[model samples]
Target chain A: MNYLHLLDYAGVAVFAATGALAASRLRLDIVGFIFFAAITGVGGGTLRDLLLGKLPVFWIKQPLFIGICVIIAVLVFFTAHLVESRYRLLLWLDAIGMAAYCVMGAMIGLEYGISPYAAIVTGISTATFGGIFRDVISGEKSVLLSDEIYISAALLGATSFVFLFSMGVPQIVAVFVGVLLAFGLRAAALLFGWTTPRYKPRQGRKIK
Target chain B: MNYLHLLDYAGVAVFAATGALAASRLRLDIVGFIFFAAITGVGGGTLRDLLLGKLPVFWIKQPLFIGICVIIAVLVFFTAHLVESRYRLLLWLDAIGMAAYCVMGAMIGLEYGISPYAAIVTGISTATFGGIFRDVISGEKSVLLSDEIYISAALLGATSFVFLFSMGVPQIVAVFVGVLLAFGLRAAALLFGWTTPRYKPRQGRKIK
Candidate 1:
């Protein structure tokens, strides 16, 4: 299998782990865990494919992806109590998944002949949307509302890939650099408490 | 335009209105209103098209639908205070939109050669997913978790449509009957405090 395909599987697995962790936090039933895992694992790619008009979606065509999500969910469900710092583990796994998906999504967008700007948007969407879907369905506060520069990391990765590819870099090299940039940035943010500035209400504004 | 086309426009408008109402309740800014409206308006149809592998998504091809969502959002933002009961108005509008979209979605599924069961699922998803997306993004409790029998209503509509069509009923008649069934069920549920039973934990089960 190609590197991209390998990254895709790893991304799906880690994303599914994060989803299972979220479900455990919510104390949802096993069905909920599976549902969350499947959705989080495939939601972003599904949206991207739909937007690009790609037929059958990636997961629908290959049921193995969903089977993997289910297996991960079952594993998480059975062993969640044994894990230390589940939330921390989830964040790290999600960061890695985001980096991989960002590069993959941008590459797919380029293959589909989308403009660079739209492709970058697609990449960011692919990286963050599954988490958004997971958080929303589980009724948790979305990471989008957090001060962490999550989307920005995805943006950096996608832009790096597109720019490098435009400059005639080989696909494998471009993908490696892109993934490294995103993962490095996200890991740094997680480790060092990096955050973006929040919009503050001006005096006498009566912010709602 | 045909009745299906007319219902599609109405569904989009009413769903957008419900989204705007949700944003207003959250005291979100104008941008939030527009964002919610656009997502809720197109969210269901987008999912349906994606599942059926339909290309270019309906709203992407016709920007007018998104434009209408924005216009409605702007109007609602300016005029929300005049509304006597926003939630009640929202529920009613959502009922109508759900009814229309349920039949439309099932018809589209049949047109795409999907099996009856899967088409019914598509119909339910089309009717309810946009609202779920809206409520989730707005951080409101979803109607899906409510006891209002919402999905059941959509299932009734879709099944009615598919069964009638399979029986050689005309498209217009099937659609009309289907819409009426869904709307009537939802309206009755709203008026009479109808509710489905929730799962109760068994003694000694220690349900998580």
Candidate 2:
């Protein structure tokens, strides 16, 4: 609850940067870059608020959040070529945003008195849906469709927070642990090239 | 306005049917079909409601819309092979839904006292976004990305409604006129293979 905006703001900026980077890869116009940035920065929270019945959403009530995104996204557009391996930078920034947003989403859900399971789902959605939107629009493969341990990391963080908080852990302690676990898992996957096992298709449809 | 649900229900059901047909193209499981159906049926309105600050969304308050989608999607799943040309059928159904949804969305937007321009955009978004979701997830080319007059049709419908209503026309007459124009434009495109002009690239970038 305390200082929530710090992490949320940082995460949104990072996500918006990823969107600009995505536009750079496609050599899109400046408007494309800004559109991508704004969507990536606020898309997740918008969906979460819709499902959670938070009227007006965060950005509408507080235009400052979107202002932050647009500024950062525009900045990224001008500085995009300075960075090599834009994909790698995107991935890393996305991981950081994922960890921060996941914790924040779960915290908000818990504050709303929703069931832990739904809260966990809300966290995962808030963390990953923006990336999904970015990937979809950019024509890049989505992290969700990848073999990488993307969502599972967010899942771990959300579950850890819900579990720890229910077990009498202090709110700040639970939040830190959740963010740490999520970032740790995601970073480890990136560092070690870890992947989840793919689903095996069944042989035939004989029962039908 | 007297029976708003009639058009909305028909449009949603048609959109859901198209989703089921999309899943059938991939021969996915029943779960996949249902998921696609639910998303395609409600995705546009969900985005609109979020932006319009309609808390809990229509489906959350009135579960019957979702129930209709689920039932229709399941039915299509079992009988998909019976259709002669699933893709063509999907396109036609989507066109019909697009026209109905475009007018309904514009009407709702006008009712909310939003500006005519925003209301027109809202109508186009409500009509086409569900199809966009369906196409993106199914790996089919989105109508938005195509040269076809997809969004333009919805645009015409929405603009027509806003203009007619503003001119003191009867709401019922305006609604019918909007739907007819949208459907007519879309149908002509599908029948005659009409396409919007492709974007031409500008020459060279300015020196930094």
| lDDT values for all models | 0.85, 0.82
lDDT of 2 by residue, B1-208 (tens): 3456788998899999999998998798988898899899988887778777876788999999889889988999999889899988998999998999999887887787666766776687689789888988888866554445676688788889889988999988899899999999989989997765432233223323
In CAPRI terms, where does candidate 1 land?
incorrect
lDDT by residue (tens digit), candidate 1, B61-167: 99989998999999999998998999989889999989999998888988987767667767876888899899887878876555566766887899899999989
Q: Ten consecutive residues with minimal summed lDDT in candidate 2 chain A?
A: A26-35
- Every prediction: chain A TM-score: 0.95, 0.93
| Candidate No. with top TM-score | 1
Docking class of 2: incorrect
Give the runs in model 2 whose Cα sits over 4 Å from its true position.
A196-208, B1-43, B50-128, B143-208
Please state the error at residue A87 of candidate 2 in Å.
Answer: 0.7
TM-score of each: 0.62, 0.60
Give residue B156's lDDT in candidate 2 (0 to 100).
Answer: 83
Query: Residues A1-208, candidate 2, lDDT per residue (tens digit)?
Result: 3467788888788888888777676565454565577678887887788778875567655657667776886687667666666788899999998998888888888888899999999999999998988889667888777777899999999899989998999988998899999999999999998888878888688855
